[model samples]
Target: MDRFRDRQQAGERLAERLVALGYGREPQVLVFALPRGGVLVAHPIAQRLGAPLDVWVVRKLGVPGHEELALGAIAAGGGRVLNEEVIRGLGIPAEAIAQVEARETQELLRRERFYRGERPPPELGGKVVLLVDDGLATGATMKAAIAAARAQRPARLVVAVPVAPPEALREMEALADTVVCLKAPPDFRAVGLWYERFPQVSDEEVLYLLRVS
Candidate 1:
């Protein structure tokens, strides 16, 4: 709603909702945020909940000709997702997928270095993990992140975002243990639209946030 000036405000609102929903307790409630927008959001929530804040890097694999359209996604440690419909519709060969994944993997590593430096990933096993993002569209990257988290055997996996398309929000529920989206508009064009100040978050900014936290 208009209550959120940006992701930070949205996260504060979301944290209040979470506390109301009964995730107010101890060590099990961990917040894992995707950079760079999610970091801003997660910071407030982590402080409010006394939860450990961390990052989970995942990148989208965009389809040829429609770079905005996700063909699938990939996360660290080789976790991957493929959109069968996009692949078939675009006639994207298996080799093509491999090529995209390969490139994206490089970008993923770059992001991880930019955002994480030498910090290790937090323990996820047996924890009630809440994954945060600014928003979602195809949800391919978030799906991959969920898969990666599942490997760590979290007690529960929750996907939370400030906004998303209604259809994408539904799809996210199938992957995570819970979905906590603030808005799911039918006319959801992009994540930026929901915010008044959706500035481009540079890699420098990402690194700065990581450093501060």
Candidate 2:
């Protein structure tokens, strides 16, 4: 089982792969990290690719009782993606889904303001946009991010992550023009399990990386 020492190491490895694939050679490239974990994973990629780094804030709408189980996700620019399978399988009602979306939407907006401050989002039209995340489990959040990026009419939308389950990777491939995942273990259970040290990223760290990049 391949394991990453930390998010930084994972980001370095992903950056190497991106460079090998002829990325980072162009000026019309923009990298969007899904904070606060994705910010660290994306920093190295942005640095190596010489791409301007930014955050695409998205909030996972967890099920009311089971907060870890993602019901859907809402992103900045009013992009939302719902898991119909999960909602129908759990017999969740519209009222419940609406409530969850409402709560997460507020947090998403708050994070966008807090992280971005007065800086306007970059122009994605006709640019190669890379959406980076630490890892993916259900991929709901990345889906929302992709939807938001697609609305902006990027020339190409790429989904990059260090590790993800094969099923989740397949789902992302359908949404993005290209998917760059370092590891897709079939028996993958959780994103944290593949890492030696997976800690919750703080807002301060996210702000620092954004400022530096």
Candidate 3:
């Protein structure tokens, strides 16, 4: 498959696929993007669907030192899901998990404040919510986001991404009412690999996108 020119292009493609799948005309649709990368991808989708755009902040509980390796993740509204296999395999103690959780929870709140400001999060009850992310890897953060969304009693929950591994999509199927993945290459590595210009999306960019919409 050809790599997307950038996140915006990937999002456009995802939006097209989503519309083809019968989501474009839904009146109750709401787009909850996982910032900061998801914001760029979601803005176009929101515009195309004429839906409200918002952020769903989720923080990874990274393993000590090896910060890229996620032990689990925590999302807004006190939703947390830990990877027990990773924890036990790494011999991470309960105390370590608690510490990591505390730290991540703080960061999650900080991000929420930074992104949404004084505005309370939008109510999801009875809404068909679309959880947008640039891509999925370990899927920990997305899982936590799904849990948090479930707490709000949305009428329907869907997870959408431009690219993800086949295995990750399979795992997400049981969590979300629908999972829309554009590309699930067998040799999938990182999400960036499928994009020609996967730049680091800055906070300023996220703020601009949120304010513009």
Candidate 4:
């Protein structure tokens, strides 16, 4: 496919692919989406697979003075992953990393509260967990999510996305039990580039999708 019309279309395509791969047949399937964009993309997957949907809140830890550069990421339930190579190469101090992590942790907690409210988190133990995201760029946030999900002892961990660069897909393959990606274009620039009508997903949209799902 050249490009998806939007996140919904991309999600429909992914859901179809997953069904073909026999994921729809899996009995104890649970879908966890990374908000706020991933939730929209995962809605169709959850519907197609007849699974419960939940959010896995994660926040990226950007490098000091260069926010775009990801130093690592943190997930709900206190799961975290840091790139020692990046920290060592950039000579980032522990204090700076601590400060960034603290700020992100607060944001993660806020999202968990706002998106989930009083709803208890899904039970992942012995369930086939399909962790869905809109797409992967650096894969830092997804890695953190995987780490968090692993702690819950899911029977199988699958990372699914609509589009990603080849290198990012390869990295994810090593982390999760299975990785399903629809398109891995060689000239991949960004996740938004793979969708023609990409737009910023708002908190309101996230709330609506979660409520319906």
The TM-score-based order of candidates, best leading, equals 3, 2, 4, 1
The runs of at least 3 residues in candidate 2 whose Cα sits more than 4 Å from the true structure, single-residue gaps closed, are none
Please write out the lDDT profile of model 3 over residues 1-213, one tens digit for every residue: 589899999889988988998888799999989998999999999988889899999999999888899999999977789999999999999998899888888888999999999999988999999999999998999999999999999999999999999999999999999999989998998999999999999999999998887
Model 4 accuracy (lDDT, Cα) = 0.93
lDDT-best of 1 and 3:
3
Clashes of each: 0, 0, 0, 0
lDDT by residue (1-213, candidate 1, tens digit) is 443588789888888877877888756888888877888888778888888777888888987667778999998756788999989988999998888888989999987876677877777789999989899978888888888888999899998888899999889888888898888888888788888888777767666665555
Residue 168 Cα positional deviation in candidate 3, in Å, after optimal superposition: 0.3
Query: Candidate 1: minimum summed lDDT over ten consecutive residues — where?
Result: 204-213
lDDT (Cα) of model 3: 0.92
State, as a TM-score between 0 and 1, how close model 1 is to the true structure: 0.92
Q: Using Cα atoms with residue i matched to residue i, what is each candidate's TM-score against the true structure? A: 0.92, 0.98, 0.98, 0.97
RMSD of 1: 1.7
Kindly provide the TM-score of model 3 when superposed on the true structure, using C-alpha atoms. 0.98
Q: C-alpha displacement of 91 in model 3, angstroms?
A: 0.7
What does candidate 2's lDDT look like per residue over 1-213, in tens digits? 779999999999999999999896877999999998999999999999998899999999999899989889989987899888999999999999999988888888888899999889998999999999999999999999999999999999999999999999999999999999999999999999999999999999999999899
Cα-based RMSD of the predictions, in order? 1.7, 0.9, 0.8, 1.0
Estimate, for each residue in 26-136, the C-alpha lDDT of model 4 and write its tens digit: 999999999989998999999999888889999999998998999999999767999999999999999999999999999899889999998889888999999999999
